[model samples]
Target chain A: MFGLETGFGEFFTNYQYPVMIIIGLTLIYLGIAKKMEPLLLVPIGLGVILVNLPWPGEGLMAYEVLNSSTGLLETIPYQDYVQPPYNMAGGEPVGLMSRIFHYGLSWEIMPPLIFLGLGALTDFGPVIANPKTLLLGAGAQFGVYFAMIVAFGLGAAGLGWFDFQMGEAASIGIIGGADGPTTIFVTNRLAPTILGATAVAAYSYMALVPIIQPPIIKLFTSKKQRQIYMKPQLRAVSNREKIIFPLMATIIIILLVPASAPLVGSFMLGNLLLVSGVTDRLSITAGGGFMNVLTILLGVAVGAQMSGFIFLQQKTLGIFALGLVAFMAATAFGVILAQIMNLFSKTKINPMIGAAGVSAVPMASRVVQRMGQKENPRNFLLMHAMGPNIAGVIGTAVAAGVFISMIG
Target chain B: MAEEIIEAPMVGKIIEVMAKVGEKIAEGDVVCTLESMKMENPLVSPIDGTVKEIKVAAGDTVQAGAEIAVIE
Candidate 1:
């Protein structure tokens, strides 16, 4: 009775905003129920739940919530209905989760750790297979640059909504590269302030690749082009060639764009285990335990920031919308570029492989294989797409390098 | 007179030669096979061409974009 008033205890005991709780719960539902990138979304839902509850651990519990948004779900633990600071004589406040949101997300330790995890999980196999696909990856980066200009224009036009300095805008714009890691890397360096928004934009867009890319691809490819029968070429890459690839890549990419070394290094290291053939144990470990752990950690770390305050901005919405556009533009751009190459070359490129030009790696390649089968069931586009799929990875890395050198 | 020459897309050992020097073919006809990535890829002719030469026999590794045959 003396220590805990029912109202104060009530505010401290439960979620203040039922809608927000449901939103957090909704993420969990999507992650688990619908299976939309569950590896990331599940942890995010848990983080959302943790950050929203009324507790000292939430950082901003010191503030009073007379009529805040979270007050909607204020749970009561005691028998006494002693009202809050407004109604009672001198009761404590109801801003527990608000405080947590302030400290946990806005403070900036989480997103970078997420990046570290993203770095640890990545593989450079696709990039290594087709080094020339790097250019297509770079070409796809046109979305980043284009988005930056748009961000800058919006900033000047009074939509100064995002804390987006030119550097921050550039970082945010990298979502167009269809590269989550690079966006994290760039934003973490240039515009640390917008880390949460940028991360959300990247992950969300990545999850939507299948939906976003197909429409864009269909728009660019006609029935004839889609049905064009390009006989598959078998690539006989030697163990020696595969082993030497990571080393040659490290040398060339590092020399050409030193800034990419960190991401390129770790990514290639993961792939090296896979291709070296001498370390089955190591390959399995990297591809399994190491990869899974990083993915889980990355999801949680990213979700750690999506609490109510910062995520509610109009710019956040803008980033999501623009990221979608960028993804499409990149896919289409890669396909058209490949089509142009087809015009000049004796050998025809399966335009379906062009869709893999975005650096989502095996995911994009898998998408290509599925679509290629849809058009022609006998056509196995996975390995062929792997050439450009991996190329896209290198391309994105090189683009990241160019961005970092100019702006880092 | 043949106007086409087929080439390798990657460096690999020619595990099998399916076509002969005078074989007439259509587009995407398997002219030779290169074993790479542990799969035998039919070095298909890009167009209707006569196999002018069997450049390499079994156990030969050719570089990427190397000419495997010519057709005209």
Candidate 2:
């Protein structure tokens, strides 16, 4: 229903549409030109602008649509009025993105779906080949605690000016783990209040991986260690072993901490598709169009919620700053753990791959391989990096569960 | 025995082919190159074998774990 503006006739008369256009264009450029996390960030940035532009008495650039059965008008969020008089007379309780957020991520639903995609894409062979990497993943989780303690101490010392108790701070810190679904899972459970902030931090840091991880990696590892060559392990793992892994993991993790079942269960579902090989079609759906659609809705909806009023607060900035430190701490701890393991073993380890223990999966592994190739072109770290890469996923999920259980 | 196929492990336009059909090669020898996520990954043969067939050649787009050639 088109309703009359009772007041503020002059306030919104001046349309600052240029700002929204520029912001949207900038994000598009970053996503396309700079090759940032184009899949998610680009959509999110565009969504931010899409919702910001003041639509003309309508929900952000949307037109009214008729409901097939009821023949009712569905006004957009930018719609001046959702309902006027008739039988029901209130506004559409929530806007477009708000409704999406409420429906998708609010109940910790979207994350499990994302995890299903992640599991389908992941290869657990390396992890099964080398179980020791599991310890390194556990070690990398130190960052979550480091950030948690630091956050608590900051709040106590009046440093953050951000409103966060230990529980909320712990959720924010797990972004350093670099596993998006688990981050969503943990944050949703521990601090649903800061879902938007925590999600932005998790994804932003995940995108900045190449930028944030390299310096931390170089700062810690010596050239000698960097130059260490890793002999590729070509041992053929049987399909039986690969298939059993996710199953066993699901049981072990869920039995130990039922809180992690969503993360673990979704992951296993995806892995089962790949290992079983009968669901190639299902795998494609999860790994392709399904993931992309959900990612767009989820990212845009999350971005819309992060308006200036909430994002510009001092606490948000502190959380961002703390997130970087926490990531570095986790990366360093992962490497040190590998080094400790190497000292006791006869076979030498490529410590560079240790950085992948933060659980960014392919990206973290790629960073290790890049550094390895930089020093020794012949050394292929993908097989080796996969060891910790996958182990990190499980470790982070478990850690997320522990944090949520303790805090919530 | 059936030959095993060596695949390009990343998605990218194939940059080069170091081996040809019927060429004798060892394990760890690069068979082809591919670019993905702004990086290159070489398709390598894990077992010492003779090149039997080349499924893809230079300048072709290949995806992760896609068969590029066969080694026997």
| Top TM-score hit | 2
Candidate 2, DockQ score (0 to 1): 0.10
Model 2: colliding residue pairs: A58-A78, A58-A79, A59-A76, A59-A77, A59-A78, A59-A79, A60-A78
Q: What are the lDDT figures for the candidates, one per model?
A: 0.63, 0.74
Q: Residue A377 lDDT in model 1?
A: 43
lDDT per residue as tens, model 2, A276-296? 878999988898888888898
Candidate 2 overall lDDT versus native: 0.74
List, for all models, the DockQ compared with the true complex. Answer: 0.08, 0.10
Q: Which docking class does model 2 fall in? A: incorrect
Off by over 4 Å in 1: A1-19, A60-132, A160-163, B1-72
Which portion of correct inter-chain contacts appears in model 1?
Answer: 0.06
